[model samples]
Each structure stands twice: as structure tokens, then as C-alpha cells.
Target: MDKKKPKKVFVEGAIPPEKIAQSVANHQSKTNIGAHSIFLGQVRADEIDGKTVYAIEYTAYKDMAEQVFHEIRESAFLKFDITCAHIYHSLGKVNKGELCLFVFTSSARRKIAIKATNYFVEEIKAKVPIFGKEIFEDETHQWKVNK
Candidate 1:
């Protein structure tokens, strides 16, 4: 039942604060949307092996990742009464405290929007082929595994 075409979900570097605002502003004309839920995934400065992570360099099998993203979006649309959904992920280096992911869902009801947003975030984290290389402050890096 996935009718939508595959979308390029990856953005370069970190997702800008202005992009989020613009997304919200862009949806104002959709009068049927009563509630919107948004999730922002920020990079954390984690300490491991006595080194602190300063950034994450992200990479993915682009073609496969885009298809998976399309499937997820279509699944969300079929499962929820959401009017709109948007997902963006960062590629390349995203520094600590910067946003790496943004998920937004809108529906006629508050609960539906929130549930759809949650579903998108969960599915993306679990199913997407995106990989992150955790870059330490000292310039060393390690491949990060999602938990």
C-alpha cells in the first residue's frame, strides 16, 4: 500500500534551526490539521574510552535508505490518520548539540499526530540503513551502533 515515491531524506551536516521553523510555517495553510507533533534528535557529547565525542559523521546506503524511508512514510500514512509527515536526517558531520534528525506529524487530533511522530522516529532508528561514525574530540572515531 505504499504509494508515495522514494524521497531523499538525508540532509548535509546538521539540520538547521531555521528549517524547522520554515517547515512549521509551510503547514499553516493546511486548515484540516489541528495538531502537530515534532521530534528533534540531537547529538550527544558522550564520553567513551576516556575520550569525548564531539561529532558524528553519518553515511548510508543511499538507495536502500531512501526506499526504506518511503516505506516507513507510507506505512505511517496508512496506519495513522495523520495529514502530513516529514522526516529529515543528517549526513556527514553533525556536531554535538546539533540536530541530526527531525520528525514531524500532523493530524486532526492531538493524539494521532503524537503517535505518528513517535512511530516515525522509532521505525527510522530501528530500520534505516544509516550509520554514524562517532568522532571523538581527539579526531579518533568509532562506528556507532544504534541501541
Candidate 2:
């Protein structure tokens, strides 16, 4: 009998690029996929209503976040004939211009890869129970989401 490996989806406390890359490689190794799409979300120091963002502190309702992410993975699998998917989001303080979210999807063709990548990122941002506190350069802060 052939065994299937488990997929990884995490609401982590701070993830490095190397770790995410390793996870992507692991998922790719499981199938003979021909395309891979990755999206990396970075914190930016920008002005909001006259305030400049200095950094961001991320937080999540972990259990719900994980559950939502899992559903996204399942939906991606059902909607697209893909090889695998992974999502990793940081849970603590992330400095400006630092990576906070990473999404990787691989498939047998480029069409599905592109579609699934877009769908994955959109769904996660809209549905996941993750929150971000944007710190202003003047020491003020506010919670932010994809607008």
C-alpha cells in the first residue's frame, strides 16, 4: 500500500524564509509537479491617515485560524487539480518590510498554479482569524487587514 504524506498549515510565532522554503521543497518532493507559485506578504512602513507604519504585531485565534487554513487547502484541492499547498503566517511582532505570510502551491500545469495561488491568498486574507497591529512611526498603532 502507498501512504500519503500530511500537508502542513501553521499559525506560527515567527517563521524564517529558509523554513518556508524547506516546507515548499518537502511538499514539491511528494509529486511530479511542473509548476509552483509562491506569494510572500511583507510588512511595509507606510503612512495611514498621516501616520507612518513602523512595524506590525500579528496575532491570531490559532485554532480557528488553523481550521480556516485547512479548509482553504481542501477547497484549493477540490477546485484545482493541484499537487500540494502550504500556508505559514507569523504570530508575533514582525518588523516593517519583513515577511509575515507565505503561500506556496504547486500543480501539474501553470494554469491551475496561477489560479490556485490567487485563490489561496485571497481566501486566507478574507477568512483567516489573523490580526495585525500596525505601529506608526510616531508610536501610534492600529489594526489592519487587506483592504
Candidate 3:
């Protein structure tokens, strides 16, 4: 019989800071890493031509999103001598200035952790099938992908 292996990285719904911290701790428990670096992306309310962004609604093609995320995890592991990595992004409505995405990478050295964090975030943004709708104070909205 083929044995199924448990997933190392978790991907789920609107991730809170507490949840992310918990996952980081869980990953760290089994890792002998000396450094952990995290990068969190937050939604910001910005005024565009007198219109103020009040909130954001996030949506994703879940199947594709998961596939993309999985690739990112594999790539990170192959590229960096890292112990573990975790990524979470919000879905549905998120208020202005709220946390949107969280990425944590731990490695035996700070240099690897830093490099991995940057590469992970960039790859996720560029490759993920996540979309965002920016809702303005006036109730108008627009869909945008991370540039």
C-alpha cells in the first residue's frame, strides 16, 4: 500500500496573525533553524482621484491557487536550504489596512531565511490566481492583481 504523506505547508481561509504564529511555531518545533523571516502584506486604503478605498474583497480560483502555491513550496525547498515554509492569504472581504498575506520561512542561517522570504513572496504574487476587488468609499470598485 502507498502511504500518504502529510502536507508541510498549510493553505486556508482568511488567516489571522494568531493562526500564522501558531503555524510558524509548529514548523519551528521540528526544525533546527537558527532564523525565521516573515513577510506580511496588508491591504491599504488609498485615495484614487478623490475616491477612497474603504475595503477589499478577495477571490481566488481555489484549485489553481492551490496548485500554484504548492509549486511555490516545492520551489522554495529546492532553491533554499530551508527547514520549512508557510503561506496564507485572506479570502472574501478584508477591511482597509488589514492583513492580506503572510509568509514565514525558517532556515539554518539568516541569509537563507531572508532570501527565501523575498523569493517566496515575489513568486506567490506573480504566480497565484488570486484577485482583489478594491471597494471605494463611494461604493465603486475595481479588480486588480498584484503587480
- Choose the strongest candidate by TM-score: 1
Off by over 4 Å in 3: 1-14
Taking the tens digit of each residue's C-alpha lDDT, what string does model 3 give over 5-102?
32433334445778776877687566578999999888788887788887888888877787788878887888999987877778888888778888
Model 2 lDDT tens row, 8-69: 45545456878776876677456688888888888888888988897888887878788788
Q: lDDT ranking from best to worst?
A: 1, 2, 3
Report every candidate's CA lDDT. 0.95, 0.81, 0.79
lDDT of 1 by residue, 1-147 (tens): 635588778999999999999999999999999999999999999999899999999999999999999999999998999999999999999999999999989999999999999999999999999999999999999999887
Model 3, residue 77: what's the lDDT? Answer: 87
Q: In lDDT terms, how accurate is model 1?
A: 0.95
- TM-score between candidate 3 and the true structure: 0.86
lDDT of 3: 0.79
Clash-forming residue pairs, model 3? none
